[model samples]
Target chain A: MSEIRWDLVKQNWVAVAANRALKPNDFPIAKMGLKAPAAGGFCPFCEGNENFTPPEITAYRPKSQANEKGWLVRAIPNKFSAFTLEGELVKTDSGIFSCYNGLGEHEVIIEDPRHGVEFHDLSPERIETVLNIFKERYQDLSSDARIKYIQIYKNRGMFAGASLEHCHSQIVGLPFVPQENSGLPKYYRDNNRCLLCDMLAQETASEERLICKTDHFTLICPYAPRFPYETWIVPQRHCEHFADINEEEVRDLARVLKKLTGVIMDCLDNPSYNLVFNTAPVNVEPEAGYHWYMELTPRLLVNAAVEIAAGIYMNPVAPELSAAMLREIMS
Target chain B: MSEIRWDLVKQNWVAVAANRALKPNDFPIAKMGLKAPAAGGFCPFCEGNENFTPPEITAYRPKSQANEKGWLVRAIPNKFSAFTLEGELVKTDSGIFSCYNGLGEHEVIIEDPRHGVEFHDLSPERIETVLNIFKERYQDLSSDARIKYIQIYKNRGMFAGASLEHCHSQIVGLPFVPQENSGLPKYYRDNNRCLLCDMLAQETASEERLICKTDHFTLICPYAPRFPYETWIVPQRHCEHFADINEEEVRDLARVLKKLTGVIMDCLDNPSYNLVFNTAPVNVEPEAGYHWYMELTPRLLVNAAVEIAAGIYMNPVAPELSAAMLREIMS
Candidate 1:
């Protein structure tokens, strides 16, 4: 039976099935220890674990010996990569739907050879080095005119499908801009202002739902949060490329990140979460009007049917309450 | 460090941070349990649970007494609804951004007060009765011209975030079409063929990736699945409205659902899953050219940073293998 309900804020539809209401105990928290470290002899990113993965494409170490150690950051080909080097970008039409070869580069960024260090735990110097690496890699990959967009992200824990037990992130370059990327930028072009900046301003002015604010960055739980406890970190200024961040801004970004993670851990009992960076297209210039920002989503509730069915969000906790909870922990 | 890898098939960007890899065990799964069911002792959806929720909007069975006994299905207003009947649809332009008042209806459909009954366990006659109920309520909600879309969904386990232990679903009607729904359909319109239809055809043609296919329906793990063991149940025909389904089709739909849920239980040790339906917009005719179907995604893996950053998907197991593994499970 359908007793129809509409989420007014999100304007999404939901039909609650009366036959399957669930209690808290019936649900299992995502088991963190399910995946042990890959047991394939040696890990490619580790100090002595070079043989386990494909040859390293790049590394941040003194150009002394061939591959004998002393690397702060390393780039290696993924052993079980989803995309690879050989295929050409050939598009074939099948009736009305068009598809092409699953070709492209899939590489892993190994932050440190030491197994358990997370991105937030990295020293400020190391974090800056990682930022520089991102800029360098983006410039190199964008040289291929076929590539249209580059996406950078980090999966933190088992809930985020990180099979390996190392603190790392992934970079993917694509041959086309997704509908979301293209459409989002179009909104910017139409309004002649950064969408996120506008949103940040509105959130700051309201202040009722503000979580944390600083000179360089602002963190807030979006009013229409797609997931519960979803937080966004945006620059106070309208900047397109993440790589364009100055040294001072990078440190600010680092501080923002540390505080963001700290709040999440304190508020949600250190729940597993994912952090993603959304920036402008690789080939685009600073004036292209894309907003670069990071979104950190803690896996508090299991997202199943409602999210998948409707594009609208179902955040049970009101944004005001969510902000209040996070604010308490932040202080 | 970021290695921007491009998924040639999906044509989306992916950022691979090998140096920033997260081990599987780093995420701690929330312990499974039932808590909120006993809270305050005013739970309305439970047997004699009528006092906890709002007054009934609709009810089935026993028309003799006024809301007294033996109701097969009951439709009632949500206690803490996201959308309230009191607000007006006042759209305000704040600078350049668009926002509106949270105005609409939110209700719950209580299937059976008895706990522990999975939807698949319901008799076919009972399932048909439920279908009739769905149709009746949908017609009732669509009477208001202001409502644009109606959504129906069921979240099963604690992982799926069901607050109560009783079996039920919620229905919410909205005033606007979501971005994804409005945008994804554009692809279908541009191609003059349903987007999902073409996708289903490809998977059906390649039976190796097919999980279950009947005359009316076909279920398969999608190629380039966003999450592992993600399965889709699509109608064989191009029916946009769920209400268009006849008696036989409803029976078949239930059968397919039961089979898939059985696979999920057996294959992944009864992992919690989300069952979502994407149907045609309420009040809108079927000429819009989109197909209606359900997406069954098991909470097998948390959506990490890579997925959120890049719209591209990274499925570890091939769909063919996943389908085969699922098919082997005895329902």
Candidate 2:
């Protein structure tokens, strides 16, 4: 029977129709459509092609060079940024419409020095270094009084909206907090507890939707996923912002990310995916009942009109089945 | 300069970055990838293949018959339905999760008899008949005490999520009012006006985003569109439900839909698009502020993680630019 389930945190309904009978083997591997870059293709994030991109804001380098090469991980301004750090955050209203000057930061984090190495292939400690850089950027951007929120994410493949084929992540500093985060306050008001912490306890204890777990972090398939095989990595401890992540938590998160991605890649053969961070905003109110988490949604199917209009996500495969398959594959 | 605009109705932010410099010609024609079914493939919606589907609930035929080859338009239960009208609408809660038994209706409206002919190719009179049938279905589904909302939409081409190549639309009778529609009450409380009514007046008066207008309806590019070339066809009258549409209004609406879709098809080179209808729910309150409208979103680019997570839509081609191009092309 199909079940219409409510997502507590996202505040949306997901219709899980198990009768669709989509087993693990039935899913299409999106990486099959992903083409490798042409031989000698000019990738801006490549070591020698650093001149093609904006100068590095920060880099993990042994030498004192800025952008000329020899950096393990690099961070630079996006060439085609959606937001810029130039204008004042002045808001204007015209009848029913309102707008703000897009005064924020958009930076790209190049994952590795080698062009072909993906983030999932890197060791957990190496990934932890990248995680540390994300935390540093979050903290650094938080100090900017104009910025209200920070969004960090990775679009992994061509199908996942990655313009550049090179493996890189993006950190966007937004002038205002988004309306989608209203679920935080809604959940907190309804139940005087941290949303993700409660969800993490529920998901782990149920064990039906548990994919994998580490010392500090646990990966679980959400009960009401918007997409099939949608997974979330929640920390065991309650934290308000991702920038507040400690070194040990970062290490465990890195380990959990690598393990979960490995299992998902093997399960669906490296499907085009989006890795998104969900954290508390810098200058937002009701700051106590927020918990930071990460969502990894594999781009398996296109969302139809019903999804775009009504916010009713149609997930054919049940999360319990998907989590069971993921656990089996991981073992 | 780029601006982060607020969408009053959708409660989301749209960052319009003209720096990306996407003009009318920059978008790719998604229909280039949309292949006609096959030389001799079996299409259930075809004229002689009436037996391939479930018996028609209702169809427009010259003579009295249930399922026949002479039907112009047909409505039938979805073969692989997401919701079935069976069992009771029982709501269950466990821990932080809540769910309802999927006891609702899902129907397919085959638009035309001929397989080669598309909806855009239909004459205004012919399209009006389809609109009438949609209204009839809406009214019929409203009588179901368990159903709460009826979402009518057309997912055209492969990218927009049409499984079969037959030109058709779907009507889903959901058991609950979707959470995306909170804007209706929010608008009423904040401004003491209907959202679409105010937006219609603003767009028509400004003329900056107006694409076309008719006696009973108007088509305009929205202030903060989620995707580039996104358009809305809103009725001029202040009706809460599309089911309340009169004969004259339906005829004018058909004309408006035809003209707008024709302009959009020409503009985007027959892009794969989703045609979604937004109206009041059947079994919900605060319906005074609701206004019925139709949305047409052409699928041009894959939304990245920032869009999926933070609900910040990135539209490279500003609505003003797209609307001007559309008007110019229409003239």
> What are the clashing pairs of model 2?
none
TM-score of 1: 0.78
List runs of model 1 lying over 4 Å from the truth: A1-48, A61-70, A180-184, A196-215, A220-223, A236-238, A284-287, A317-331, B1-45, B59-72, B161-165, B179-238, B284-286, B321-331
Per-residue lDDT of model 2, residues A1-331, tens digit only: 2222222212332222312322212212222233345786666788888888999999888785898878888989988776778757765576776655557888999989787788799899888889989999999999988888999999987557776667789999887777555666667777787667777788778898898777888888776666567788888888878999998898888888888887777766666789998888886554566678888988766677877787666655667777787877755
Instruction: Give model 1 RMSD, 1 decimal.
Output: 9.5
Q: iRMS value of model 1?
A: 14.1
User: How well does candidate 2 score on lDDT at residue A78?
Assistant: 85
TM-score of chain B of each: 0.79, 0.87
User: Judged by TM-score, which candidate is best?
Assistant: 2
Model 1 chain B lowest lDDT segment of ten: B2-11
**What clash count goes with each model?**
72, 0
Q: What are the lDDT scores of the predictions, listed in order? A: 0.62, 0.74
DockQ of each: 0.18, 0.18
lDDT of 2 by residue, B1-331 (tens): 2222222212342222212322212222222234356888678889988899999999988785779778888999998676668767675576776555666788999999888787888899889989999999999999988888899999886557666778899999887777555676567777788888887888889999898787888888776677667788889999988899999999888887787788767767666689988888887664567788888988765667876777666656667777777778755
lDDT for each residue of candidate 1 in B153-267, tens digit (9 for 90 to 100): 7766665656565667778776655433453467666767667777677767766658777879888765444445667788888887777787788887766766677657665
The 10 consecutive residues of candidate 2 chain B with the worst lDDT sum are B22-31
